[model samples]
Target: MENAPLPSKPHYAILDGLRGVAAVLVVIFHLFEAHATSHLDQIINHGYLAVDFFFLLSGFVIGYAYDDRWQKMSIGEFFKRRLVRLQPMVVMGMIVGAAFFYFQASKLFPMIAEVPVWKMLLVMLIGFTLLPLPPSLDIRGWQEMHPLDGPGWSLFFEYVANILYALFVRKFSNTALAVLVFLSACFLIHLTITGPNGDVIGGWSLTPEQLHVGFARVLYPFFAGLLLCRTIKLTRVNNAFLYCSLLILAVFAMPRIGGADRLWLNGLYESFSIIFVFPLIVFLGASGAVKSNFSARVCKFFGDISYPIYITHYPLIYTYTAWVQDNKIPIREAFPVALLVLASSVALAYACLKLYDEPVRRWLQKKLGPAKVYQKA
Candidate 1:
């Protein structure tokens, strides 16, 4: 009975709502990203920080979900649970990218026309495994690890974080975890402030520099989230969903600080947000209650679709980006079309959630049997 799986605990609904909010902002950021010349000039400038926010959220959730269950759960079982939760969307995201692969061909993706169908399928297969592709295998000129879906790179690193947590970090004392989080924060600050771009972007590629950026970006937020879950005492907050959602938006939409001459200032802002602001938001969100029926429903809906939208929306973004680049369309001219793309992406994500993701996960869980479940703390 110790090894038998248990029922799922109730979720922190407001946190789910916040995740959906950040995901939607990511879509808008990418839409605006298609128009920007560089990281410094990009509109919705801080949108990339959403990835860090996500890492933090993931760490906290993982801690909440699994920390108590380890006594009953083996590491292998833990991996099985995570795979069941995350892998389905990973597969679907890649397929969506492949389905829209050729449609994205344009001056921006010069290599698409040259890529054979078999090769594209091959890339999709590799993407299915969530393995980072070497630059030589890059079918798209963008040199992304998963060209089929750019955001898949984050999922790859996400898997890395999960592996670390399950294998080792899960056993750390609260003090040790805090120390690790501190060191990670220092590394993140150093990397962000000293980097050529002065931002925590460029973790999608498999290059050494990008890999460094990837590790730097992931470690602090993820472990800090874990540390947070371990140490913090929750207090009830009013309108946690509303307040946290607004904070996420404000952070992601904040303009680039200090401009080109003061790149480190922008880095400092990003560091402060991840280290201080995000944890506060998560804590507040966890402390919040969904008292109103309307608020509960909103949180439920957003929470349900958050991962679906985050994982699957980028293929449409690829097409929209191609259109913008090929025609050199300005943001004003492309606003209507961008809105349509956002709508379509949302629709696609909801459809995937209902038709594909939910059904598939149920089937897999049924087949795999339950691993472990913890009661709400």
Candidate 2:
């Protein structure tokens, strides 16, 4: 289906809602983890894998969003829409992350003490995707914002995948095979070439040997989503059941992520986040239905805030956790506080999307002109 005709758009409230579900899952998961320790968070700890869920959603949405011009899209317009849609909030997220860390630097990241303030600022700016760099080819400043830290890594890949779709996606024969080959080469290469802890696995450093090798591995998951997006269709009973089942599976898988016993889950989430979760989500999402249940609203709302929630929850987790540690708050109070953090984050995200994201996206679109129609290759 990766090479098939593009699917229809709209009435995909379900897909968008699922995106919301992934967002809220991450938020709630973080909220639970930030406070009282829980076997629930760990056992169901696989909720963090919701990012992979987003990747698959992204691929399909990109496919659906640009179905008409998939074969003829200009890199400029494709990127313009993406930048318009994603940047303002992303930049805001970076600023928020940086400001929060700066205000509490003494408590937030001890690593900043080693690097000069200028260097840290550079990292923050590089990580932020809102800004564009010069054409000199020497600035090395394309590093989208890591303000919320690690999750920002996915945004860069999403941009690349989307652009690649615009430019080269039409010509690839057996795109699924191409994706698998890409995933395999990356994983095998990383396993063979790296130290016990090479650069491709973690986020503390993006330019180290690890990042050089790690980026390859991420493609597997991201493209897996793209592939799923191409193929997925929804039914009433079976599809809804499947999505619910996958959520159940992830819940069960979560506990397998925490503590001394969770080495593989932790490693997988860190190293092959895409490989691990993309297939599961794609399978479920493609097959899942948008049922008329109350939970559906939760899915839509969180999916809406998933972006903001994803960006905002971390600071709240770190800051709230620190306060809990310092004050020795009981599990009960910490749990409630975590819930409040999520509620507040969602409210903030609503404002961010409604006020900042919507307007900025329109303004950018007007300046960039319309998306070019297909002249299929």
Candidate 3:
């Protein structure tokens, strides 16, 4: 009976909608990224913060979904559940990236054409496992861990956070967890403030510095989110979905806080947002009820495609970025193409969600032994 499937829980629909919102912002951010020479000039300046927001959401969702099932569920089972949820999309993202690999060759990606088929396939195979490729294996000239799908870096850290939760952090008392969160918050603050970029903008590579950035970025938000789940007293908040969605957009759409000379100021702003604004948003999201059938449907639709869009959109962005760079088209003239890429990415993500991710996950769960009936938070 210990291995029996647990019943799934209801989702926080508003949180799911917010996640979809953030994922969309991340896509727009990446599109703008192709044009910006520096972070300051980037149009959606704080869009990178969306990753941090995701970590927060993940932490909250994981806690809400799993914190109480440990007596009945083994660590191995917990991992299997996570794998079923995440690994399918990871593989799809890598496959999508591999399929688009050759077409992305341009001045922006000089190494794409030089990369051999065998090497590219090898990378794709490695990517299926979500293992971080060392710089030596960087096929696309960018020093991304998963060069095929760059955003897989966050997923990698996400797995690390999960491992820590399963092995150690999940057992920590609220007080202990609070201490850890405090120290992690301090580390996050220091890393963001003192960094050359004056922002929490890295964690894609395998080097010591990037790894430090990644850990700092993941630890605080993820654990803070977990801590919030354990301690939060959710109050009834009216119109939480609407209010939280707008707040998230406003945060991501914010301008760079400080320019080159005052990087610490930007760091402080980021720190404040992660430490305060994000958790508040999560609390509100969780507290708010999905009152209307229309609102419920909207939340469900966004929630359904959120992960698919996030995991799968970057490959398309790579192609779009290449098209812009190869043609030497100005961002102003390239606006139409950018819009097309955005719409196409949305279409592609929804298609993958329906055609591949859901089917593959359903198959995996059935074959993998006792299906853990966890919430789709």
Candidate 4:
């Protein structure tokens, strides 16, 4: 059973739902993060790791879906399929970000409204292509590659991983891939241990240092996940989804293990969690089955909306963060508003999914050619 060949097009239903679960946690974590002064005391301290988990999951899914199909699928076709599945949401996220930009302005961005409409629109235009603009083009104070939409940074890195996979990584032997994972793991460890913040946090900006962080953060888990899918030996596990979900929450919600004084300890924990825990969680998720129709539907709904919610919700978060900053409201007092923001983000994501992303993707697939066999979400 451990070495079983997967069904031709098996759906990793539990993995999909768990991806949604992590996305939701990321929103919660970001909401609470606005209130914290530092990582040491930040609520949902490790939620940043969700991005890494996503990378890992992506690698695993890509390997599972396309590794053997390379015999028939052109690299160009692989790129096209990915663009169809991912680019629609990327465009929507940018549009949402730009539309909400003015609402997010406050003392933090006092000149936001005064900035020329053409400049903002220019940023949004660049955003649609998923390209990172230089700092000179950064209208927002954060120096993000996509100032209009901060999450665009991750998508940029995601594309880098995809290109590497298509052109180079797909050809590696098992030993070579193991070595790649090891080297990436080393870089990750060094980064975590020496990072000024003692965590894997700063990757959104376009600066050289930030790009280094981004690449370092992505390389391991993505490749590791690819390797995991190739070598995974599944086993029976009862209540796998519930257990794995809890495991993920525990890692993300766990307080920073070592304070700033013992930075190595924190670094070790972060590295170990990514290098070991995340892949294990993904494996458990893949092995699990959705045993009930209710569970099946729940998984499908979350899976369907997960990417939409992730890409689009950040604009709403920017608004909420701005409000919290403007009012100087503490999280305790702003609790009700925080709840509203969370609920609204979910509602907005679902709306975008049905109203925009799904339709655009369907149109894209139709125009591009028949869709590939991989699952969309």
Model 4's number of clashes is 0
Per-residue lDDT of 1-377 in model 2, one digit per residue for the tens? 22233233354555665666667677776555545454433334566556545655676666556755645445565666577667777777766666665444334344433545665566568657533222221112223235334456666666666666777774455565466646654663455244343213332234554354435544555555555556555444456534654563564254443345444444544444445445554555545566667656755664567687676556666566557665677667666777788788788789877887667766765666653222100
lDDT of each: 0.90, 0.55, 0.92, 0.87
Tens-digit lDDT track for model 4 on 34-132? 898788998899998999999999999999888987767788778888898899889899999999998877887776867788999999999999988
Score candidate 1 by lDDT.
0.90
Instruction: Output the lDDT of residue 195, model 1.
Output: 89
Sort the predicted structures by lDDT, highest score first: 3, 1, 4, 2
* Stretches > 4 Å off in candidate 2: 1-8, 35-43, 106-127, 130-150, 175-182, 185-201, 209-217, 231-253, 257-280, 288-299, 327-330, 371-377
Higher TM-score: candidate 3 or 4? 3
lDDT (tens digit, per residue) of candidate 3 on 1-377: 43688888877988988899889999999999888877899898999999999999999999999999888889998888899999999999999999999989888899998999999999999999999999999999889999999999999999999999999999999999999999999999999899998899999999999999999999999999999999999999999988998998888888888788999999999999999999999999999999999999999888888899999999999998888767778899999989999999899999999999888888987788766564463
Per lDDT, the best of the predicted structures is 3
As for TM-score, the candidate ahead, 2 or 4, is 4
TM-score, candidate 4, is: 0.96
Q: What is the C-alpha RMSD of each candidate to the true structure, in Å?
A: 1.6, 6.6, 1.1, 3.7
- Model 3 CA RMSD to the hidden true structure, in angstroms: 1.1
Please report, as a residue range, the 10-residue window in candidate 4 with the lowest summed lDDT. 1-10
